[model samples]
Target chain A: MASSPTTLRLAVCLFDQVTALDYQGPIEILGFLDPNNVKPDVPTPSYLLEITYLARTLEPIKATAGPRALADRTYDEVGDGEQFDLILVPGGQGARPEKVPSSLLEFLKRQAPGAKHVLSVCTGSWILARAGLLQGKKATTNKSVFKAVVENIHGYGIDWIPKARFVVNDDKKIWTSSGVTAGMDMANAFLEYLVGKEAALRIRGIVELSAKEEGDDEFAEYYHLL
Target chain B: MASSPTTLRLAVCLFDQVTALDYQGPIEILGFLDPNNVKPDVPTPSYLLEITYLARTLEPIKATAGPRALADRTYDEVGDGEQFDLILVPGGQGARPEKVPSSLLEFLKRQAPGAKHVLSVCTGSWILARAGLLQGKKATTNKSVFKAVVENIHGYGIDWIPKARFVVNDDKKIWTSSGVTAGMDMANAFLEYLVGKEAALRIRGIVELSAKEEGDDEFAEYYHLL
Candidate 1:
């Protein structure tokens, strides 16, 4: 990586009934990965992120809440040959295996395998597991449904940690986080890993927000992640 | 209020170049306030929040980032005769006085005065101040550019606090927060103030996220907010 790698193309998955924060929180944090949003004073990172919202179509994907994000392109549009630098998948009530669109699963299987980084927020990890990308990798998911989701998806050779804030599989190039807002924390950790502490610190400073390692995760105990 | 207020109308303003998380974070947190997203197992709050995205037009309001959210109605369509239970204002680089649309100022002037709650996230407080809504009221804005923005809009009778995470003016029904993501903390604090601690705690538990009172804003000091 040079002082800046010029551009890092990102493919962000959007879907109906998606939990908006799962992806939105991390997306905002990762926006700092874009060089265009950089300030002159901040120590520049090695790459700039250019995000493209991907869905089944170009229409607005309705989130579980009233909020909706208009997709920039469809899964088919990317084609099997198109390789993204990063792939971000978010989760919601609609993320259940029975409810997820086949196109989304097929798209993930094709793109995520070759992407530089594959990140999943909340139950999005479940989707990645479904796509066979989580096999032989360490990952985590939304704890509220962690046991049910992980148990249902067992036998994939994946190490599922219910009490983790986020688990990174540098070997597999996969990063998975617990629950919704935890995505923000994972994004921060992943950004620091890729872009260095100086860049990550600048973003947190500007936003008056923190991206920290919150491993206590009381929900794990409450939900009995066993 | 009573055992449960039943319904609470919300007007969330969206615009081109708006910081998505400024409003998105709040919207996700407040989704619990709406009856539709509530689960029977999770304890319900006293009221249900009904949100309506109000923009300059009914078109898709583009965020500075790649995401875009469609507006449910327009400012002109909201009309002064219609009063919202709450008015949520989000900010971005485009939120400056010279850049904000006149229609937004007109809409705020007409609507915010009568709304049950007037909330501003990030530099959204700057917009409220421009509309004369923050006059003689304690408030804050995005600390990254807080001092300069506050100084530029001086003589609005604004008691701008550079270090505060968020401030509440119960008499004026105004709530202002710092920077982009601080809106979530403010939202958490405001929810507790209005609906009670139990509801706020439950929501935090369910999401497995925490928003703290970060008043000693290091960004304010680093940026020389003094």
Candidate 2:
């Protein structure tokens, strides 16, 4: 008899002025967890992820670009104490440390301890840093604002990797990626970690995405952040 | 004084069971048109896009994955006679030729005649083909479903390119891309076509997306479509 697939609940944080790609990209890559969606009809992976989009209100959340997105639930509905298997924070105009909401920080602070994994893309790491969850951890953020993020979030003691497309702190169950589209690369790596290389490779092939390694980041050098 | 930015209206098609990434990825690349969101803040491009998401109705449109997306208008709101500068169609379960709404086909048949550009990603081309927009035009679709799509859509007389990431019909102002993530690559190229190489290169740098040439498709060979 086959073993039961592990069900992972995911919380995707949404906010006004969020960059559409920062979160949407990862969702696209990770969405292949549903076996029916995978091309060539691959067997079900050992893990299945149930995604929930959360926001402060049920109102439509306007992104920095593209169409607005609707959240599945509000932060108040989930409460700070609710634990999820995975928590995703995506960066955009709203994620600027100064612009981030106290509610998001408080929610992260309350949930990170109990979450199995916490992931972020672009300046989403700034929210994680501001929440103090990345203290003494290795992480990366959007390369364009790399210096500003590192300077602004003083004393987090976070090792902000300058030359990484994505950083994974296995000990802390945290993954951080750089910029808008890098989230897809990080999600690809995360998929490999959750399932295996073969499954990840299959999805990558289906999507026709060329995978970039953690150290393959050229933006760090482009922005003189290295 | 610099010339006033040209406002190009965009119509994004949405439906139930649409693939989030299929549409979201291109929007991320193209959304850089809003000068305020660009990193390092370059001068505004000559053309600015006003995006409007169009669906059959105003209710939140659920994608095949991730959060639900809200449309800016309904098909009735835009009417079949409305014209747009650009029209984007993304593919997923709902985009199957048989599943697509006649309202969408009518909208495309009406709009494609006057739109500056009409773009489709993944199985989105199938919708175009069914709408008779891609008749005798060069195009491509998701490689996993390439054979089925080509075989299924009969008498379109479309030049289906098996060894390409995206296909552009300059004469017809039609652009189609392969699979899901390939939309980003096509959008990058489309950006160049709209704003010039330098501007597109800068946006690519900010987003950390490496450009892929239209002929750089590996999935074609992977699926033996080449």
Candidate 3:
């Protein structure tokens, strides 16, 4: 929001059985916001992101598919008034109602209210819906299991879109995406919103990503969600 | 190669300043090979991958941008005769000659010969090239910094291809990909090779990845590498 270099604190939520790609895809795209990784001649970057990986504890959190990721801090460790500019919740088997930790939902309920923006990858929206954040909101989730997941989570007061790669809330405070790799596409658009199109394009160019738009989802049709 | 279920051990090399996406994109795609994630009625999974993250030390390996990854074992801790079915080398700022650890190169040199498949994402090929493993082999690296990186690494004798998304040598033992996100495409193709086209397609469909072929690179033209 400033001409001078500004830093945005990002809180990445991690839990056991979390899909590594859900967080990794977005983190990889957003990592380009680091000024050190950006070109020196770019004058001032719109924002330099400072990322913090949060988990229930400081121990290594095992992903659904294998590979363990270490968290920087525990959700309980954050002070009462502490807030971040961005919050990321990734989905996996851990996102199920029975498996999802109440502590995480509580953390999100606290942090999301104060955060500038909240993002959920795949069924992470399920957790958000479970936490009552998605009530009266428009969102989408992983399509392969769309019917099964969305049908059971009744009375959330959410408008679930079936044929979209990602959907943003009317207020623009919340962003949600389809299955795994869609996080990268959502993140590309999210970066464009945060920085500018030019900056986002440069980042995507370096990573060689052909950013797909919100309406460009083919999986929606393939899965017969449309 | 067995008809019955078989687990392939994967060694993921990590270092300070390594780009997270370089490995994450591929690992995410490859993780689906796990039988647990696969449908029970699918009969038999071609291969189930067991991933092991390796680093110079047991401490968290900080990436070039932000966030840190924990390693399962130190390279030295791996037994002398131990072998991995698949070895992954990911690149970032740390992949440079001065920044890379000697121990990593030594471990790669020792491990690669015994590996069934050696994969390098982004400038991870630089590491492979530096390890003297790319000699008399065809390969590709991240295109943005391609010229500068390959030019300086003299006498590796690698037939560096400038206009490809990824390259596989005559023997198909080594696979090198262009830039960060291109690793996913490489992994997609690699999955098809390891498993079957049907299985890879199912995995990609669930992840919603519109797989890109080897020559579907626009970066080559964008960077004037062609």
Q: List the residue pairs that clash in candidate 2.
A: none
Candidate 3 regions exceeding 4 Å error are A41-43, B41-43
Docking class of 2: medium
lDDT tens readout by residue for model 1, B1-226: 3485668899998888888888988888788887778866556677889999888887788777657789888888886567888999999877987778788889998987778899999989989989998877999988888878878997888888877888888574999998888888888887787678888877766566666774745566767876
Q: What is the DockQ of candidate 1?
A: 0.63
What is the lDDT, from 0 to 100, of the residue B105 in candidate 3? 96
After the best TM-score superposition of candidate 2, give how far the Cα of residue B77 lies from its true spot, in angstroms: 2.1
- lDDT string for model 2 (B83-150, tens) is 79899999988998667877888888888889999999999999999989988899999998899999
Sorted on lDDT, best first, the list reads 2, 3, 1
Summarize candidate 2's per-residue lDDT along A63-129 as a digit string, tens digits.
Answer: 9887788888887677644578899999988998667767778778888889989999999999999
Each model's total of backbone clashes? 3, 0, 0
- Candidate 3 pairs with clashing backbones: none
